[model samples]
Target chain A: MKLRVIGAVAILLSVIIASCQSEEQQEFQRYYNGGKIIYEQRCQNCHSAKGEGLSNLIPPLTDATYLKTNKAALACLVKYGIKETIITINGKSYEGAMPATDLAPVDIAKVLTYVTNSFGNKMGIVTSEQIDKDLLKCK
Target chain B: MKKLTGALFIILLYTACKFNAADTPKLPIYGNRDTASKVVNGKTVIDSVYQTIPSFKFVNQYGDSITNKSLNGYVYVADFFFTTCPSICPIMHRNMLKVYDDYKNVSDFKIISHTIDPKHDSVAVLKKYADKLGISGNSWWLLQGKKEETYQLGEKSYLVAVKEDSGTPGGYVHQGWFVLIDKQKRIRGYYDGTDEKQVDKLRADIKTLLAETNTNIAQ
Candidate 1:
């Protein structure tokens, strides 16, 4: 009887874990879809649909190292334009300045999350709170 | 009733043939038209003679003067944009770059990028901008000329619109058109430089123009 009770507990725990994972997956999908729409409307013209960017004129966001290391700067850059600085990604330098996007904090977060997690990246999601904090620190 | 049906069918066939003949694509020769008298089948007929693009001079990114003389016997594409443009210029630049790449190896084909903001985009600035875009050699030229002359060329030569506006982001407004000029310096086609599909059409039309040039030379 004790073994049967333990087995029931194991089944319940597995079911809860599965549901939790699915819920997380669903939330990620929501962020990704919303972020894709925003990116297509605003960012795709310069950065391209896959974030591959134009040749030497714009920097590619596909580099996982760049995206992971510059998470805060990415959020800030989205809110405010990066002027007077040349950004280098994966040893290739881009000279053009990134224009500031007039996106809200929530939308900025979604775009950041979408880019970071896309184009062969798995850097995870960026929250609106993070974007708000980053924007506060933008120069 | 049968005879009426036969007559209607004959009329429809004639109309369709006439329409198909009219639909044949022909390059328009722009500018002032002049009438020339011709005797055809013992009858006097008047035909219109079309003019070509007028001669002008502008300084290229290298600070060298480029004139209509330099563009003689060549097919070219021309457009207007400024470097610091915050909006449509980049899209146009990207599209123009695609056209440049496609025709870079072709002889006697050129791309002229004239800056509407000539004051800010001097020879030095245009040179730097061209360098940043990796545009080297003579296939493409970044031109900076007098504001009045550039504006006039935009309206008169390329048949594009340009003006200044304080409320606009770039402080100036211009159309995003790549005007295709044939070897005779006549405007052949205009493509929206910001649209990829239009740029594709521009590429295809370039091929057609080149074929037409070849056929003329052969003749």
Candidate 2:
């Protein structure tokens, strides 16, 4: 009788945990899918579809360390566009101007979430709330 | 009804013959052509005069003057773009880099890119751009010249539309065409440089042209 009661409680706990995980997974899937469309529309040309950039003329997004370190600044960079600033990535200095996009804050969050998660990166969802908070601190 | 059947049979046979003729792949010669008739050894000889690219002088990224004569013995592809085009130039060049990598080792192949915005894309700027693009040696040349000269050469010789407009994103309008020129300076083919499939076809066609040593096959 005690084993039966324990089994019932264990099954219920497992069900609750699975449901909880799926909720987070569902949010990730939503952001990733939405961000993929935005990436293809806007970023694919320069950063490339596989994120292998076009030679030294453009910087590759496959560098996870760069993305991780510059996580806070990425939202601003995507929204306002980077000017003729020389940025060093993969030990090489690249000086080029990236045109600005009119993507909204939430869309920026989605796209950032997409880029950071894809391209050999495992950074979790960059939420819209976090993007809004980061935008306020962009230099 | 019998006559109609015979005519339809003949038409089908003719179309089949045309399809067979097209099986051997050959790049089409573009632009207008005229026939020249002359008497050779007391026989009436008719020859087709193909439109060829005229000679022009321009400076390359190395600050070297490159003219049409330098490219006489080599098969070359020509394109027009500025260093700072925000829209299609990057994509065009990105596609073109495949062509560059494929044929960079061949001594008889060359790629020439003319800067339509010569005012900003000077020799130094072009050189810097080339260096940044990680392109070296004479396999590819970033040519810059008088803006009007480049535009005229682009529009008239290559048959590509190019103009300046303030409304455009880059302040200039141009087609993303990679014009393939044969050793004889005739326009052999034109590929849309922005599309990967077209660029792939361009690469394949370049191989076809290189293997096409005999003049009779092209006819």
Candidate 3:
């Protein structure tokens, strides 16, 4: 009888663990979905839903050159502001100023993660740890 | 009846195309500014593209040397950003991604990004940021150098303004305008990288630039 009881307990435990795993997956999806919301509220103004930029003024994050080369710089730009800077994109020169924003680290991570993933930008995840590292530099 | 409808549709399409073509006039390759303005403290009267894009050395995301001389005779799009910007950086980057892909095939054009927060946006950090953005090779550059020089370039050469505001939580504050420089290094146009209408204007300007490259000046 005790052995049978043990088997039943084991099965129950397995079922619970499986449910928990599924729940975790759902939670992650929520976070990703939340990132989309954030993108619409904040990112859509400057970066159109299509990710096409405003002429020669802004560099497109969807391009492989930026996704491949300036991941860290991109992060810093999102966290801090490019107060006075000059950048070249697609064989053009632009001297513009970008100010820092006031989003938290997690929000920054999710938004950046969204940009890194969207617009043909197939790049790795930008974790909160990486955001923290970039934030430290901003300080 | 079906054949008549199809013929009418074709005629309408052709008329629309013709109307659009006629409505769009040939704008200058780079925009023209007729005013004599003071970029700096009542000194250095600016003229044309020849007076802009002066030679200066700065490090790329990979920490390589980049100078105005190095980029001579090339068309490019340049903007400024740091890794930690919270508001428009992501949006600007999203649009920039499109610009990069659209022009990735054009060998004569390149992309440049300047770090406004130089003290914090170092080469190593910029490299990591570039990596996250999936930027690789020589197609794009994230540059950073002295703060004053960059500010001057933005204010005078590029004709944009910048300043730092520690009172604001972000430590540094600045404008969000993007300047378009021509092959001859002249300030051709200014666009709101954060605005959609302005971006469309930029796209049209780029198309104009490409078309004008093959045409000779009509003196």
Candidate 4:
């Protein structure tokens, strides 16, 4: 009986420990407004408020089709503006070289994260580290 | 002599007609005149421009339930943000408070702030934040609810950008915009939530929208 009681207590403790060890909550640092202030000051003029590209002038960020296939292209576009180039969103096409902005890598990460997440487009999180890697690749 | 006589006769005739026309039973300019009717039409068009509020129910800062119906017939500014945001959220929120303070007593205006990060930004946390901001009464309402719903409302309904990002400067992220909703709840325009000059433009537009009568509702 003593052994059984000890065994039960041990099982209970282990269960508690297991519960506490749950991995659902991961430690990840999010962007500060995803460079929202920087984006507004610099990007809102062309991107518009809702991330919906201006009619025929710019491509909407919520373009589900483009988002599915052009993740790298999107990053590259932000890092290096598409001057005198055209990009398509959804089915519509846009022609304009969005000026290559002078934002830091972290700022780029935040703004890209914001654009990806907003405008009915829900891409995963973008990190400054990722931005750094991506920037290096571009160079 | 003949030409002079003809000119004088013509002048007299013109003067007489003009005098008679002025004296004829003229329509009252105050209430029932063409100019008045045109002014009335302009007001009607202005009022028609405001949009209708969509139906939604969410928790308020006081942990109380609030809905779109509560904001019926009121002009309010709506924006989405999370508390721990380390970026434009603070600046945007400060600007929103400024708007609220200026228009709290106006009766026709109100403010709604929705949290994009519902999991972390519970009613309790939002309540604390609102208290910190000194929001009391019905003038300003802080809301939090299902994350997807908030995102949809921000992007589709309000025509502003919002999303859930784990890599934001904080743990969450959203747009830096203050969307202007007229009394009828239509999106009149969007202003830079973080820029002071843009905020001023927002204020002027708000005043203008308020002055215009709510008229059109695009179904």
Candidate 5:
């Protein structure tokens, strides 16, 4: 009877843990789906559907190292365009200007979350607060 | 035995239909908006010769004057874009680069990029823009001409739309079509410049046109 009671408690704990993980996953999914719609409308024209950018013209977002290194600049890039700048990714150079988008802070966060977490990346979610803070520090 | 034979017959018929569907029809050659007749051994043959691009003058990236005659006997792709466009021009420009890379080796193949906003994209600006994009030589010519003439060519010759709109993100608006012109200066195909898959199809069709031209020369 003692062993039976312990097993019941263990099973209950596992169920609770799994439910909590799934809920977090569901929240990420909501952000991802919302971000995808916004990305398709605003970014897909140049970045492409799969984030595989054009040859030497637009830089690819699938590059995990570049995304991680330039995470702060990305928020600014989305809100304010980068002009006359040379972006080097994986030994290749691109010199195209990314025009500024007219998206809100929430939308910018969602888009950042989507791109960072997608295309062979899992960089976690970005909140509106983070985007607001980052935008303030943009050069 | 009869049921097996029926199934086999159905399968054969389905394969036959699939084969037929795979055969693409020859693309139509458009002619000038005029019809003429000729007498071929007393038979009235309607001779509607293929229409060609109208003669026009424009300045290339190197400030060299380029006319329709200069581009004769070459297969070329043409599109219109501006330098500072914040909308679809970037996507179109990227896809055009792909087409350029694919056919850059062919000596007679060229790509023409016309700017509708001539006031901003002058010869110097276009030259600088071309250098920024790492495009050298005459393989890709970024042409800036009179705005009205360029818009006319876009509408009449290329069969694409172009206009200035204030409400759009970019001040100017134009279609995203990459037009394929044959050696004879006739439009052979049109592909969406914003879609990579469609650009791939355009590349394949260019090969088909080149092969067809070779076969004609041999004959």
Candidate 6:
């Protein structure tokens, strides 16, 4: 199909383009790009494109302090979803249930990296290995 | 002599533009219509009647009874949604808030959202949801009533689809259409509630309808 050919060319072009960059930079680029698509598809509806969240309903993801403090638990929150609990974000308490996703650990890391990095909070790339460790500690 | 004719031509062009500007764009009336021939003043006359939003009764978020008669004079937008909808309802309302903010102060404009899942989304639940979504006043009313009546009104009158589906995320399926009804209770347009662009178009069309009615009353 035409779509398959275009996709193949895009992948090949990316590989050639990424050859110039270091391994670490390439890894981050891959995760960041992949995470952007995932975030737009899954989280953009509620959190909004800018992660500003719905007013008094869904909590914003722009709280850098909250993301930093709960860095380890982010994976669990994305994977298992949030229950009926009020959490304070940016000085506002939001109560609602977030539907759990069936995404794998790597997806969790990719999306987390995208969320943290783009939304005025830069915490670097969260790897699948780190996500595996965090999932074990989910409570 | 040529200069005088040029000045006259300029005046003619100005009048032409003015005439065109005076004629405002109008929204097309949507829905089925029928014509009946009758004798008036000993002459046979044909009159066309457009389909309108039929009579229905439901309770708003404030527990006040809302009938089609309640919205008789006001131009209103109608849509079907539930509180705990996980898929499209959030985005639909988010986009709708833009329209709400634009016309909240306008007395003749209103928005009514009927709930398809009346059993779970009771009067109290709709109230809470409205509160959380920053909705207040009579401008926007979230109505809840018998499930069958609500679904029938949405599908039959508003021309939007509504059904109960357990396999879906929210356990119900419905189109995210913001149906615009004129002061005469006829549908003017339908906009995809989930898309910001379409919602923007809906607001523009609302202004057109309002202007059309305002001029009619002024004349």
Report DockQ per prediction, comma-separated. 0.41, 0.51, 0.12, 0.01, 0.29, 0.56
**Worst 10 contiguous positions by lDDT, candidate 4 chain A:** A23-32
TM-score of each: 0.81, 0.85, 0.52, 0.47, 0.79, 0.87
Off by over 4 Å in 5: A1-22, A55-57, A62-66, A83-97, B1-25, B38-45
Tell me what fraction of the real C-alpha contacts between chains A and B each candidate also makes.
0.46, 0.58, 0.21, 0.00, 0.33, 0.67
TM-score values for chain B across all models: 0.83, 0.86, 0.74, 0.72, 0.84, 0.88
The residue-by-residue lDDT of candidate 2 on A24-106, one tens digit each, is: 79998899999999999899877888998778888999999899999999999998888999999989888889988899999
Candidate 5 chain B lowest-lDDT run of ten: B22-31
Which stretches of candidate 1 lie above 4 Å from their native place? A1-21, B1-45
Error in Å for residue B139 of model 4: 0.7
DockQ of 5: 0.29
lDDT of 2 by residue, B1-219 (tens): 999999999999999999977655377888889999999999999998988999899999999999999997888899999998887888898998899999999988999999999999999999999988889999999999888899999998999999999999879999999999988888999999989999999999888887663343456
> Per-residue lDDT tens digits of candidate 5, residues A1-139?
9999999999999999887887668877888889999998998877887898755667899899999999988899999988879888888887767888799999999999899998998998888889999999998
Span of ten consecutive residues with least summed lDDT in model 3 chain B: B24-33
Candidate 6 whole-model C-alpha lDDT, 0 to 1: 0.91
Best lDDT goes to which candidate?
6
Off by over 4 Å in 6: A1-20, B1-25
Candidate order, DockQ descending? 6, 2, 1, 5, 3, 4
The residue-by-residue lDDT of candidate 1 on B114-216, one tens digit each, is: 8989889999989988887878999999988889988988897777899888888769888899999998777788889989899999998898888788777
TM-score of chain A, predicted model 5, versus the true chain A, to 2 decimals = 0.83
- The whole-model lDDT of each prediction reads 0.85, 0.91, 0.70, 0.70, 0.85, 0.91
Tens digits of per-residue lDDT for model 1 on A14-130? 999887787668877787889999988888877777787766777788899888777788877887878858888999977767778789999998888889888899877778888
lDDT score at residue B152, model 6, on the 0-100 scale: 85
Better of 1 and 6 by DockQ: 6
Backbone clash pairs for candidate 6 read none
Q: Which residue pairs clash within candidate 5? A: none
Candidate 2 CAPRI-style tier? medium
